[model samples]
Target: MITFILRRLATGVAMLVTISITAFVLLNLGATDTARRLVGQTASAEIVARKAAELGLDRPLGERFFEWITAALTGDLGRSWQSGQSVVDAIATRLPVTLSLTIGAVIVSAALAIALGALAAGRRGWTDRVVQVLSVIGGAIPGFLIALILVLVFAISLRWFPATGYVRPEDSLGGWLATIALPVIALSIGAIGSVAQQVRGSMIDALRHDYVRTLRARGLPHHRVVYRHVLRNAAGPALSTLGLQFIVMFGGAVIVEQVFSLPGIGQSAVAATVVGDVPFVMGIVIVTAILVVIVNLAVDLLQGWLNPKVRLS
Candidate 1:
């Protein structure tokens, strides 16, 4: 198990390095000059050149990439070209809101998926059909559309919660939760469908195995047979799929944040992109890549723990 974990961690680090390189190259490939975009259009050519030089953009591409990576490792993510503020500070300020929303969405989605999936698998009749229909509807609708509808119904008409913006949890936990409730629900809807589908499929497949049949023939209670034997065996693949779904949810939250006017990393990334704030954009990309690598590693470890056969091998 230790050896497997170490190998997977090494691979994850390599993958993150590749992601960083790709993000850096793509961000710098655009026509807009970062210095000019930051300094303003009316600035003289000489001034722009001097600013670019000061920022080390005038150096060779290899040197610039090396500098960026070195600075990142040392905890200096560079200054935002637009605001002249440290990119790290900006990210720190916005991290709480994004984390709050992401965590809430994941919790809601995971609980609902597991419950609905197990229920559908055990029932396997009209209840299963109903769940399937709901899952399809959930998968078909876009998150932004769901957010809009939720705002119209719950915020505008019902006036139950604020329609936009975020409040720090420290100020008022209730208000913070209320403001994010709609957005989290919107983000979770699609995730629930995907996770439930995977869980149900895995459960059904596990139930058909010879070991499950033997347990049933041995006069085990139906609940114990389904939950203890079948579901336990099925959990390995479901958990792996859940981790991948979480990564997808994080990426999709960007659009959901924009539509809902939530102040999150997604909104910051979009703002940076529009204004060509290279450092800020790259910072977000690097953070996202790191998160993906870490999540994948964690999932691999979890799979090994859940399935001893994998660990032993």
Candidate 2:
């Protein structure tokens, strides 16, 4: 298990390094003159050139990347070129909002997926058809549209939740949950559909397996045979799908944050990218990549726990 964990961590580190370098190169290589943007467009050419030089846009890419990575390793991501705020500090402030939405969505989606998927698999009639239809509808709709509908219905019409903004869980727990509820539901629809489909398929296959039959023949109760044996076996694939959904939600969160005015890493990334805040954008990339790595590692650990053979492999 230790070896497996070490190997995954090493892979994650390599991935983070690769992503950081790529983001830096791409941001710098773009034609959108970061210096000119930093200065007013009406600024003289000479002034723009001087600004570029000051910002090290004149430096070789390799040299700049080396300096940036070294500083990053030492926990200095540099201040935003636009706002002059420490990149790390800016991200730290907003990370919790994104995490709350994403983690909440994941938890909701998983619970819904298990119940819907198991029902579809076990019942296998009109109930199965209904679940399949709902899954299809859920998967077909875009998340931003879902967010809009939720805001319109729950926030505007019913006034059950706030239409925009966020509240810290520490500040007011009820306010926090109410603020995040719509966003979480909007984010979860597609994930629940995808994961539930995977679960239903995996469960059906597991139910048909020889071991399931043997357990049943050995006088095991139907619920025990299904829940303890079949569901556990089916969960491995569903978990992988759910992990992928978690990553997808980050992208969706960008649009959702804009619609709902939630301050999060997604919103920060958008703001930074618009002004070509290279250091801040790079910080967002690194932090998001690190999160993806951590989630992937968690999924791997869960899979290993569920099936010991995964650790051996």
TM-score leader: 2
Regions of candidate 1 where Cα sits further than 4 Å from its true position: none
Once model 2 is optimally superposed onto the true structure by TM-score, how far is the C-alpha of residue 19 displaced, in angstroms?
Answer: 0.9
lDDT of 1 by residue, 118-187 (tens): 8899899999998889999998998889988999999999999888888788998898889899989988
- TM per candidate comes to 0.94, 0.97
- Which candidate ranks first by lDDT, i.e. highest? 2
In Å, residue 40's CA in model 2 sits off its true spot by: 1.8
